[model samples]
Target chain A: MSKIAVIGLGSMGYGMAQSCLRAGHDTWGVDINADAMARFAAEGGRAGALPADLDIAMIVVLNAAQTEAVLFGETGIVADLPKGAVVIACATVPPEFALKMQERCAKAGVLYLDAPISGGSVKAANGQLSIMASGSAQAFAAARPALDATAETVFELGDSAGAGSAMKAVNQLLAGVHIATMAEALTFGMTQGVTPDKFVEVISKCAGSSWMLENRAPHIVDGDYTPRSSVNIWPKDLGIVLDIAKSAQFSAPITAVALQQFVAAAGMGFGGEDDAAVAKVYARNAGLTLPGEDA
Target chain B: MSKIAVIGLGSMGYGMAQSCLRAGHDTWGVDINADAMARFAAEGGRAGALPADLDIAMIVVLNAAQTEAVLFGETGIVADLPKGAVVIACATVPPEFALKMQERCAKAGVLYLDAPISGGSVKAANGQLSIMASGSAQAFAAARPALDATAETVFELGDSAGAGSAMKAVNQLLAGVHIATMAEALTFGMTQGVTPDKFVEVISKCAGSSWMLENRAPHIVDGDYTPRSSVNIWPKDLGIVLDIAKSAQFSAPITAVALQQFVAAAGMGFGGEDDAAVAKVYARNAGLTLPGEDA
Candidate 1:
């Protein structure tokens, strides 16, 4: 069995660490949150220092900065990691940052897989995430055990880094925009006397529907803002997308416009609410109340 | 067989007329374009004026202006229609305008079903279009034969004139925004080294995919913009959406932004190309050549 260390212990990371434990690996769950690490320990996950013989280390932090801090920061794990081990970075980061990380890991005699994950927290817990991965043959080989335990679909995008992250940014661009647009359309329908429920019912069956629409519009219908994926996520993810696009001289007006909606949602103190709460921005603007909101 | 008159034999209308013929209706196909009318005649569609005993006169026109002109204009058909005949108005019009048309048709002793259709020309020709119909019991009854022949799914929105058009506007809001967003995302992928083919292959399977992306992105990959649905359609449809939103005092910034992209596309002389050609706007903006364009 592989000796796996999952750093972060957040929604995605905790679930992934559990998947590794379920697969009979010696799994360690590390996080700044002491309660999370202790809870993992209660569930048969190893706590404390990662083993010197760690076979795979999956970085599931928030973004590039955290990923860099954990891998190359003051108390970095790369220097302690065994040669030939793999670092499966599962954050949504810039392709250039991923390339830089991969190069830094290579110098430490470690393999780095530029793997950005999809499917939400529920899918992560069930070991059904779709991973877009890229790295060397050695990186793929070393990361195989955790991957088998955690992912239902692994898209091996290229033999080197960057391509996987590139695909992830493209996907984030589509996903973030769709959620915001779904909210925009739903609220717009309300002003036309189309109720939230009717909007979900008809649009889901129509050609306008997207995967995100089918998944999230129901939340608006129910007036739930419980953050399966929080509103704050878009500002971070889409910000990364817009950053990359700007660096590439790409004109993503829709993405730029969509980012502003998420930012407005955040400004309105809905950063931690479900992303569907972006509709509330439209609702507030149009002076219309959503399903559960008071008129 | 029902005596059916399908006016406006454009791509969508001619297809609906063909569907009526396929279903054994005694269908009369009419159009200002003599070429389109003659082509329908070549396909066994009946030629000549609509009979006074017409059971269903489907106004498959361009907008509220044409619909108003056809139903109440000089030499309008409502004056010649039999009392019990149904006018199935199949255009994406404002809900208020639909209410006005229903009132006029009622005064003329004709039943009116405010029906707006979805599904592209291919679905129209195959009799698989989705129709959102709202009218009284008698109107529904009178329009039943034509609805059965022309639509696969009839969403009975309400027993009124405006509801069907309201739902159509809602559907259009989502549909038009989705098509433009697909173009935006696909071309954004290109600027980041994601090829058009790879963008389609990966994103379609990822969370970013919408119905428009799955159906239209391949057109970009193959470098074919043969107008399965033209770019010009968006300016018309989304303009209707924005118009309705404006009347409702609704703020639709994303939609307003998306409309600009299509408008820019039209301004760039791609008005006649497929709606997927909106990617060309993004392409030109970023100084990147699309798959089928010369670099």
Candidate 2:
């Protein structure tokens, strides 16, 4: 079994850390939150200090800034890793930032795998996350054990760092826009007297349906805004997408408009609520009450 | 056999007319185009003047204006129909317009079924179209025979005229946005080196997918924009959506953005091309050549 360190014991990272432990890896869970680290330790995970012969450092942090800090900051773990060790970056970061990280890792005689994950926290715990991965063959070979334990599908996008992150940005573009569009359609239906329940019932079977719609619309139907994925995610994720598009001179007008809706939702203090709560922005604008709202 | 007249024998109407004929209705196909009329006549459809004893006048025209023209304009058929005969209006119209037509038809002692259809022309021919219907019980009873002939599922929305049209508007809002978002995502993937074929294979199975993505991405992969549903349909359909949204004072920013993409596609002279050709707008904007284009 490989010695694996999973930094950032948030929803996705904690599940991934558990998956590694379940797969018989000598797994370590690291987080700023002491309670999360203690919880992982209770669940047969190593909690304190880095192992000298770490095989894989799976960074499942939030974004580029956090990922960079966890990797190369003053008290970073990259300096603590042995030669030939792989750093599996599982953050949704810009492709250019991923490339730069790979270069820095190379200079330090460390392998870097650009691995942005999908399928959310539940899938991560079940070891069924989809990992969009790219790096050198050596990095792939080094990261294989951790990947096998954590991912159901690993899309080997290219023999480099940037491609996987690029694909992830593309996915975020679609996924973010789809959630907002679902909100727009559902609330627009409300204005026309189609209830949230009926909107979910009919549209889920129709060509109007998306993976985001089918998955998220039911949350609106149930009037549960508990953040499976929060409204705050879109501004960050779609912000990365639009930034990438801007760098490439790509005109993503739909993505732009969708980003605005998420921003509106965030501005309305629904940022921490479920992304389905974007429908509240529409409901408020049209003066219609959603399923569980007071009129 | 019920005596039925299907006006505007275009792709959807012609197939619906054929479905009626197949169901053993004495169906009369009417169109301004002589070729369409001749074709339907060869397919066992009556190509002639309206039968005065018409039990069902199914107006499968384009929009609100055309539907109004066919039912109440110069040389209208509503005055020609027998009293108690039903006018099964199968066009995507404003709910208000539908209620207006229903009220007007009531004055002429005719029942009106506000029926807006879904599923494409293929489903239309196979008599498996989904009909969103609402009207009085008398109208439902009168239109039942024609509905059974042409629709696999008839959603009886309400005991009035507006609900069916309202649902149709909701469906169109989601459908239109999903299509444009698919193009946006696919083209964005192209900018990231994900080929059109790989996109269909991967994204179709991912949370990024929509029903439109799975259905229309193949047309792009094959480089065939053969107008299964033309780009021209969106400006009309989404225009109707925005109109309805405006009436309710609903802000549909995502739908508004998607509508602009289709309008751009139409302005790019791909109005007659498959709605999938909205990808062309993204491709052009990004300087990316899609598969089957001379790069």
Candidate 3:
């Protein structure tokens, strides 16, 4: 078993750390929250300092900034990581940012794998996440233990850094827009006398359905806004997408409109709620009450 | 066997007429295009005027105007249709328009089934389309033979006229947004060095995928613009959606945005091409070349 360190014990990272331990790795959990680190240690995660011979350091922070801060801040772990240890970056970051991180890791005699994960926290805990990864041959080899521990599907995109992140951006573009579109459609259906339950029941079988629609629409149907994934995610992830699109002179009008909806949801104080709560933005705008709401 | 007339023998109607014939119905094919009528007659469809004893008159026309014209305009078939015969309207018209048609049909001593179909020409020919249908008990019972002949899945939306059309609008909202968003995302990926083949290869298996993306993105990948469904279909369908939303005072910004993209595509003269050619709007705006396009 390899020695692995998973930094940032958020919903995704904490579960990933548990998966590493379950896979018989000498796993270490590091987080800004002492409670999270202590919780991991109680679950048999190795406490205190990370092993000097760590095989992989997974950065599962929120966005590119947090990822950089975790890897290169004053107390960054890269300085002391072993030469061949791989840093598996599992955040949705810009392709250029991923390339820069790979270069910096390489200069420090460390390997870097650009890995942005899909499937959510439940899958993360179950070791069934899908990983879009690209890196050098050595980097893949070094990161395999954590990958096998955490992911059910690993898409080996290319033998470089940015392809994985680029693919991830493309995915985020669709996924983010799909969730917002699902809300828009569901509420629009409400305006037309199609109830949320009927919307889920029928559309799920129709040509109109998407993975996001199927996964998230039911949450709206139940009026449960508990954040399986929150509304705030789209603004950040789609922000990365639009930023990259701007640099490339790409016009993503649907994505732009979708981002505005998420931003509106956030502005309405539903940022921490499940992304499906985006239907609330539509609900409020159209003067319709969703399921489980005070009509 | 039910005596049936399938009006407006376009791509969808022609196939549906063939399906009805295959199911042993005495089906007539009617269209302004005499060539389509002649073609249907050569394929064993009944020739000459619709039977006076017609049990079902399936109006598979283009829009509300065509549907209305077929039902109640000068020399319209509804006037002569038997009192017990069902009129299955299979066009994508507004829900409110459907209610009006149902009321008119009731006044004419005719039964109305607000039955709008899904799946495309191939499914129509195969007798495997999904039909979103609603009407009174008499209407459904009268329309059963035609529904059985033409549809694989029949969604019995409600025992009323407008619900089927409402559900169809909901489905169309998602369907239309998905196609345009597929184009937007596919072209967005191209700008980031994710080739069309790779985009399809990866995204189809990821959470980003939709039925439209899987079905339509390949058309982009192959650079084929032959209209399985045309770009022009969106402006009309979404136009109906926005019109309905406006009457309800519902704001559908993303759909509004998606509609603009299709309008732009039509503006760019790709209206008659495959709906996937909406990617061309994105390609031109981003200055990115799609597969099979001259770079």
Candidate 4:
């Protein structure tokens, strides 16, 4: 029922675009890759130049800079959007950047919802993602259909742009660190005669478990480094955290250390692999072979 | 009913002693502090020197050194314990130390259960702690009555001493880092207009949460740093982690960074406060005042 444009056809964005189409929206898929656009069209997604009468432009780009370029760059969608159309920014950007985007969108007669998402690619595909959303009432009203289509849970954080992003940053800080810690713990257990399967079995039931641990540990157990969420994500996401921390003068030493591990994983050429591959970093350092990995 | 002695009537040990009593055991409370012992006695804990005929001696002492001294020092209890009496070592010591204790206890005709506990003081009092246990079948058999009384979940990881401590170390690696990361995220949220209360309310629902975050974030929101688990615990626990990491030649950068934050908190004179007060390091570094602290 709504005219929606979803830019950035990455794993998350592609799924979200499908969700909008699945909800029977007048959806438009935009991506740098023509293959993604063609694939979306093949999957019954509407294809055309985004209609000037667009009700929502959901930007799911990589970072703050890309989001800015998408909105204010040459041929920016904000210029194409009609008055009162909403822009749901779904990047894990800093709160300040979100506030700035909200202000810029307002100047263009657009409502901006700082709606960063979680629950990863699978949930994104299932239309069961969690959206940490904050915006003005008008922005929420404008963006409701896409939200209803894509999110099973939408945390309505506050009536401001940055609050949603702030909460997302908090979540990323924990999520990123937890993934690395899971790897560290799992491999450390390997050094002590606790097998990968047993590490998964025991720790998941114990107080040591996290959402990330539960989600990612099995990847290591199966020796499957296929990217459910790649090791490359942490550097970008934790980079956002460090940027926010630096700006706020907040010292996030744990987050800083976690960033280093992901960097190490990336450095060790596991960047494109599943984030759980971080266990390999620990295992390699300690001379322990994880389940399914070579000696 | 088995005859049981719970040494070291600290917050955790005292509650454990009460749990043993509640389970219908003839529980003896032992502590260097006469007041703790008297308090336990007033609560119907049996008063006497530990009996030589004790069926179980649960040494819920402080650290590796204390646990060692309690079992093998000149005035040690292992020599005093009857043959086949189980000594449940419920402190977070190294796995190597645990194996050493098991060997020493074995020489004295005793069984040793490497039973490090979780669920904190509240669960300790309720006789519902989770114990990560590994030892011989005979050791488990000898410790059954006390184990049944005190633990709701007992992970029988291996039929020897080291695996339980290894798992505990893995757990401590996650838990200690999680506490600091919670502090980091909570304070980071404050910089972006997310109140401590709202941070708790929102993030708890998001994927960014951990077991420690749910457990410890409330302490910060209430601005109560009452040492439910003090800052001093991390340096010791994560020190154990790094020691184990070093022995295995495993590089734990995140654990190293988290340990430093707790150490800084100790230096800031908040060491005696709850581990949640690690937020103080972030707060002071960023010039942000937390909920109850004087601005």
Candidate 5:
């Protein structure tokens, strides 16, 4: 069993930490939230400070800034990490940022793997997430135990850092836009006479259906905006997409409009609700009532 | 066997006519294109004018105007159609227009089944199309032979004309946005080194995928613009969606943007190409060369 530290014990991170611990790794879970750390300890995660000879540091933080803070900021673990230890970065960040982190880690004789994850919290806890990963062979070897623990499918994208993050951005672009479009069409159907249940029943079998639509539309049908994935995710994820598109001079008009809808959803204070709650913006705009709403 | 007339022998119409003939119906195929009609005749379709005692007049025309023109224009078929014969309207039109046509057809003692078809030309030819239908019980009974011959799945939406058309518009809204978004994400991926081939390989297995993406991305990977479903269909279909949304006071911003991308593709002179050619818009904007293009 490898020695591993999984920083940021949020939903995904906590589940990943659990997967590592379940796989018989000596795993430490770190988070600013003490309760999260305590809960992980209660679930058989290693207690106390991270060991110096850690084999893998899996950072499942939110964004680039937080990822950097955890790796290289004051009280950062990169300097504390033993040489040859792999830092498996799992956050969705720009490709350039991943490359930069890889370069800085390499200068300190540390291996870095750009590994952005797919599938959600449940998948993470089940050790069935898909990981899009790229780095040196040594990085891959050092990170293998944790990767084996947490991921069901590991797409070896390239022999470098940027490719995994690039693919993740591409995925986030499609995923975020799909969620918003599902909301747009479902609510638009409501403006006609198609009920939310009927929309789910019929469209899921039709060509219009997406993975996100099939996964999230039932939440709207049940009127449960319990935030499996929140509306706040789009503005951040699509922001990365548009930023990347701008640098490449690519025109992503559909993604642009999809981002605006999510922004509107956030502005309407549904940011913390389920991403399907984006339908509420359309429902409100058209003066229609969603399922489970006050009529 | 029922006496049937299948009008508008285009790709979808001609295939539908073949399906009717295959089902042992005494079917007549009519089209402005003589070669199409001649081809249908060679395939066992009956020749000459539609019979006066026809049990079904299935108008598989392009849009609402053509549907209206075929039914009530100069030399209109409704005047020639026998009483109680069903008119299976298979084009995408506004729900309001479907209701209006139902009213007009009812005055002539004729039945109208608002049956907007899905599945493309291949399924049309194979008699495996999905038909979203709504009409009176008598209308459905009259149209049953043709529907049975042509549709693999028939969604009986409601007891009237508007519901089928409304559901179709919703499907079109999502389908159209999905096609454009696939192009958007695919080319956007290209800008970041995610090749079209790798894109289809990976995203099809991920949550980012849609039915349209799985169906259309291959055309991009092969760089084939063969018109399985041409780019021209979107402007007309999404135009109907935005028009209906406007009437409903529904703000469909994502659909509006998707419409613009299709418009741009048409403006770029890809109207005759497959719908996947929408990727060319993003490819051109980003200075990327798609497969099989002169780089």
Candidate 6:
């Protein structure tokens, strides 16, 4: 019923494009990678330049820079979008950046929604992601079709741009730190002869566990570092958090320490592996063999 | 109906003593503070010095030092306990320290059960605590009555002294880090204009959440600092974690960073306040007012 374009056809974007198509929307998928574009086209997504009469432009790029490049860069889409159309930005950018983007979009007669998403790749493919969204009422009305197609939960955070991104930063702060800390505790337990399997078995029921612990510990238990969310994500996400903390003069020591661990994991060449592979850093440091790492 | 003595009639110990009495045991409550002992006595607990013929002695003291003083120091009770009796040590102590106590008790022909408890003061009162316990088969057999009386979940970790304490350390490592991290995330949310109430509501449903967040965030939302668990407990517990990590040559930066926040909270004279009051340190740094604090 709606004409939609999903920019930056990464793991999340490609799935979101599929969800739009599944909902019977006229969907266009755009990516720098030719393979991704070809794959989306093979999956029945439209492959041409987005039609100017698009109802929604879902930006699922990596960061503010990529988001801006897509919306306001050379061959910018927002200026090309018809009046009253909505641009849903799904990058984990700062609240200030989101607000600024909203202001710029408003000046161009384009509605912008701060709509950073969660629930990861699998959920994205299943049309079951959670969206933290805040924008004008008109923007919400315009973006409804895409939202209804993609999200299982939509937290309407506020009536403006900054609040949704603010909440996203808060979630990222906790998520990144928890993932690294799970690695720390799992590996620390290993030193005491608590195997990864036992760590998952017992701690999951104890007061010590977190959502990240229950979700990611199995990766270490199986020695599977396939990047559900890669080691590279923490540096970028926690960096956004630290930057926001710096701007707010907030001291987040635990977040800082967690950032260092992720950086260390990346430094050790595990950047492309699953974020749970942060445990491999601890495993190596303590000379312990993680599951599947035994020689 | 086993004859048992519970040392240290503090909040946790008193509840444990009541649980023992409720289980039809002849439970003796002892404390340096006569008021605590008298209070438990008024609640149907036996009031007297521990009888030497005590079949089991449960030491529910505060720390490694207190556990040591109560068991082996001047007027040490381990020597006074009857031969073949069991001592269920319910203090959070280093695995090495638990092993040492087990050895000392063995020399006196006594059984020692390394039994560190969880579930806090409320669970203790309800006889629903989780006990992480290890020792010989005889020690488990002898302490079975007390375990049944006081614990709803008893983790029989191993038939040795160190494993129980080691498991407790692992739990504490996860737990202490979690509490501090919850405070960190909640306060970070505040800096982003996310109210304490909203932070609790939203994060509790997200992957960012932990058991500690659900348990402690309400105290912040209500602005109450009643000492469910004191800020001082973290420095002590996380210090034990850091010490163990050091011994294992395991680097625990996140735990180390979290420990510093609690140390700061303690240094700011909030050592007596509830552990949730660590948010005060964040609030002060960011010039944000928490729900219960004076702006």
Look at candidate 4 and tell me the lDDT of residue B203. Answer: 80
Candidate with more favorable, higher DockQ: 1 or 5 = 5
* Candidate 6 deviant stretches above 4 angstroms: none
- lDDT digits (tens) for residues B1-295 of candidate 6: 9998999888789899999999999999999999998888898888977776899899999888999899899989877778999999998898889999999999999999999999889999999999989999999999999999999999888888988888888888888888888888888888888988888888888888898888998999999999988999899988998899999999998999899989999999999999998889888888888896677
Please tell me how candidate 4 rates in CAPRI terms: medium
Instruction: Write down the DockQ of candidate 5.
Output: 0.90
* TM match of model 4 to true structure: 0.98
Candidate 2 lDDT for residue B6: 94
lDDT of each: 0.92, 0.92, 0.93, 0.90, 0.94, 0.91
lDDT of 2 by residue, A138-175 (tens): 99999999999999999988899998898888888989
Per-residue CA lDDT of model 5 for A102-196, tens digit only, reads: 99999999999999999988999999999999999999999999999999999999999999999999999999999999999999998889999
Residue B240 in model 1: shift from native, Å? 0.7
How big is the positional error of residue A28 in model 5, measured in Å on the Cα after superposition? 0.1
Which candidate number has the best DockQ? Answer: 3
> DockQ for model 4?
0.79
Worst ten-residue run, lDDT, model 4 chain A? Answer: A286-295
For A155-272, candidate 6 gives per-residue lDDT tens digits of 9999999999999999999889889888999898888877788788878888888999999999999989998889998999999999999999998989998998899999999999
Estimated TM-score per prediction?
0.99, 0.97, 0.99, 0.98, 0.99, 0.98
RMSD to the hidden true structure, all candidates: 0.9, 1.4, 0.9, 1.3, 0.9, 1.2
Per-residue lDDT tens digits of candidate 4, residues B224-287? 9887889999999999989988988888888898899999999999888999999999988888
* Candidate 6, position A6, lDDT: 94
Cα-based RMSD of candidate 6? 1.2
Please estimate how well model 2 matches the true structure, expressed as its whole-model Cα lDDT.
Answer: 0.92
Rank candidates, DockQ, best first.
3, 5, 1, 6, 2, 4
Query: Per-residue lDDT of B1-295 in model 3, one digit per residue for the tens?
Result: 9899999898899999999999999999999998899999999997698877899999999899999999989989999988888999999999889999999999989999999999988999999999999999999999999999999999999988889999998888899999999988888887778889999999999999999999999999898999988999999999999999999999999999999989999999999999999999999998888888899
lDDT winner among the candidates? 5
